[model samples]
Target: MKVVFHPDFYQVYTSDPAAAKGRMEAVVKVIDPFAGFVTAEMADHNDVAAVHTEAHIDEVRRQRLYPVAMLAAGGAVQAAQIGLAEPCFALVRPPGHHASADASWGFCYFNNMAVAIASLKNRGRIDSAYVLDIDLHYGDGTVNILGDKSYVTVHNVDAMRRDAYLREVADAMDRCEADIIGISAGFDNHMEDWGGVLSTGDYFEIGKMAAGAARRNSGGCFAVLEGGYNHDVLGQNVLALIQGMAA
Candidate 1:
């Protein structure tokens, strides 16, 4: 699978764990040997503006976060575009699930999913999209911007049990009817991670289900990194998902 990434993602963009040192390196160490890498570019300012406010964009610049944030968004766009043809993963960060159109928090600066999906819609590549956010936390940012757009349906899975979560994903995938499916792949729910509700194998199942859904709908599928924080096992978890998607 092609992974959209940039070496700059290795820079500690913030004090948040999502941008902590070695976080990207840990995942990179494991996937580098097998994963095909695609260099990420900075998102066009117009694309960023399409999903964010001018004030929010300026605020990011004031905090010296504009450059990297745009790169992450750009990586998402690249991943989404690649997904139209094949499965891919955007392994870039400053995880954007928590960001909104006008505000941001939880280690996010811009809503990358919103930007990427909106761009695809704007270019007439997809008429509708399904977003599956499996992060430990809700992806309110994505919903805040795209919920009312009519072209997107966002599902943030928060089942408390491992089996329940998987079932929730299965149910959603089974019901999906869209031109594309995107996974907000987060590993924080892993047994060794923050949520401690899911196992590493679960990610693979989620990925496989997503791939199946896309195939069934004759659509495309892709993923972007979110809130996995356990460096020791983060790489393995991500790899499992990628392997399943590629399979």
Candidate 2:
């Protein structure tokens, strides 16, 4: 697996836990030996503008988050594109699932998943997409932008129990039919993280199911960074997902 990342992602851009110090480092240290890396670039202004309102972009700039936010979005796009041939993961932040078209919260600025999928669509790289957001919270921002699109299906698993959650993911993957699949990977749901519902091995299952779905569809799959605050276990959880995807 090729992971899209940048050293700048190590910078603590905000007081938010998503951007907290050592958050990126924890994940990187674990995955570095297991996977190849691809440098992330800042998203083109036009690409960012494609999914975000000018007002929203301006607001991010006003907060001095434009650079890092755009970089994260770019990393997402890179991961998505690379996924066309093989599985990839964007180890960048701030998490964007809570960000909407014109408003953002949950430590997000631009909707990185939306921007990347839209960029692929705009470039005629893919005819359809499936987004599986395994975040602890709902991916309202991703839905707000890509939900209504006839070519996309954004599934934010709402199941809480371990069995129910895995079943839901399995069912979704069984039904998935698209040119590409993207995972809004968030480890906050880990037993040691904020949500405390899933285990590290559960993440591997999710990733395997997603990769299997993509393979069944004869398409591609990828993931991007999201919420996972427990530094102690965050790296292991992320690596589990990556290993599964690579499987």
The numbered model that scores best in lDDT is 2
| Residue 137 alpha-carbon offset, candidate 2, angstroms | 0.4
At residue 16, give the lDDT of candidate 2. 87
RMSD of each: 0.7, 0.6
How do the residues 11-111 of candidate 2 rate in per-residue lDDT, one tens digit apiece?
A: 99999899999998999999899979999999999988998899999999999999999999999999999999999999999889888999999999999
Q: Quote each prediction's TM-score.
A: 0.99, 0.99
Q: Against the hidden true structure, what lDDT does model 1 obtain?
A: 0.93
> lDDT tens digits, residues 1-247, model 1?
8999999999987788998999999999999987999999999888889999999999999999999999999999999999999999999998898889999999999888989998999889999999999999999999999889887999999899988989999999999998899999889999999999998888989999999999999999999999999999999999999998988
TM-score, candidate 1, is 0.99
User: What is the TM-score of candidate 2?
Assistant: 0.99
Collision count of model 2: 0
**Model 1 regions lying over 4 Å from their true place:** none
